[model samples]
Target: MSKVVLITGGSSGIGKAIGDYLSSRNYTVYGTSRNPDTIQNSLFPLLKMDVCNLESIESAISELIEATGKIDVLINNAGVGITGPIEETPTEEMKKAFDTNLYGPINVIKTVLPYMRSQKRGHIINITSIAGYMGLPYRGIYSATKSALEITIEAMRMETLQFGIKMTNVAPGDFATNIAAGRYHAPVLENSPYKEAYSSTLKMMNEHVDHGEDPSKMAKVVHQIIENENPKIHYKVGAPMQKFSIVLKRILPDKVYERMLLKHYGLK
Candidate 1:
């Protein structure tokens, strides 16, 4: 039998692309959405699961395991985006973003570990973002969530090794997906001092996503990672310039890195 793979947020966007690509290559792919009925034309089965809900996650994984006997890989791609000035954004909104982007994956990872452990081998791929590498204007919450998830994945890399479970974070650069349309815009009051800056910055970032790289490119990169006998702990897939930014951040001074981000986002 082909290896079984489970992908969260596979209803669309990068998750959908990966689901399609992997299944076509003969991997027994299973994609999950909050409402499986909405998932159409998928090459593999659609499982109803909301990463934010523990019950939902448990039910879905249990069903997958019952039928497949084991889960060989899991792609934690379910996440939401929240944007606004960090100070103006309500605490509750940021919490919700964290719940979905960070906590949701944690819940899923924990649930799947026992299965992966008993089997003696499994791969857990966390779909992180380039935003995790740097704080972006108006997208501070999104960045924080992804950044936290990456840190957690790093810890799991060491913790899960003895069980033969490998955890890796895939930080994909800007990608054209439905994320822009679904992003929550934090409330910015009219009298807020950051109004003008917030407006311009939000627009700039959203458009960048609108014209981002194709999702299929990232899917191929993910495929390679899955096939590798031993994948690295972290992989950034996207434009050379975006990948270079990570390198620059590591070598450059703090002020220099901030300036580059400002200029790129038209905030300078």
Candidate 2:
């Protein structure tokens, strides 16, 4: 029998690419989205799920397990991003991001663990980002959410090992996707003291994403993780420079690393 894989935010971009790739490879793929109708044309079935809502997350998982018997893999790929100075970013926007990017994955895992425990075998893949390693200038809140998720996922792996559940956080670098269309941006450019700085950084950031890695590349990484009996605790998917940044974060002095980031984004 094919392994049943459940991926969140699969309506488009990275999630969609993963679902399609896995389905083609004969994995029993199911994706969750806010609107299943919108992705009816997709290769896999999509369950209606607003990951930020516990009731909705619970309902989606219950429905999936009821029909499929078990979810062999859970990919926590649903997330949103935000940008602005930490001081000036609106509280509501940050809350919205934390709800979706961090809390959503936490709640979904809580809901699914019972089934995985019963089966004594499962893999939970949390899709984070390289920015999580070191917070970005304009994207501080967004990076914080990912960093927090990475830390949480670390503990989850240790706790669930007894149940033979494998867990890992995949930190993707800038990947070409439609995330910009859904991003929650701050209104800092018009009246903020850092208006010029924000503009320059924003342009650089957007261009970087425009030329980022292919989303399909991350899908391949997912496939490899699924096939490997013991995958690494964290996987960073991107070009050499992007992946190596994580290493730089580990080895560089705080002041030097900070300077590098500032210079890279033209914030200096």
Candidate 1 per-residue C-alpha lDDT over 1-268 given as tens digits, one digit per residue, 9 for 90 to 100: 8989999999899999999999889999999999999766778798999888999999999999999999999999998989998888889889889999999999999999999989999999999998899888888889999999999989978998999999999999999999988878976679989888888888887787899999999899999999999999999998899899999999999999999988887777
Stretches of candidate 2 off by over 4 Å are none
Ten residues in sequence with the least summed lDDT for candidate 1: 180-189
Best by lDDT: 2
Clashes of each: 0, 0
Q: What does the lDDT come to for candidate 2?
A: 0.92
Worst 10 residues of 2 by lDDT: 180-189
lDDT of each: 0.91, 0.92
Q: What is the lDDT of residue 79 in candidate 1?
A: 89
For candidate 1, what is the TM-score?
A: 0.97
| Candidate 1 pairs with clashing backbones | none
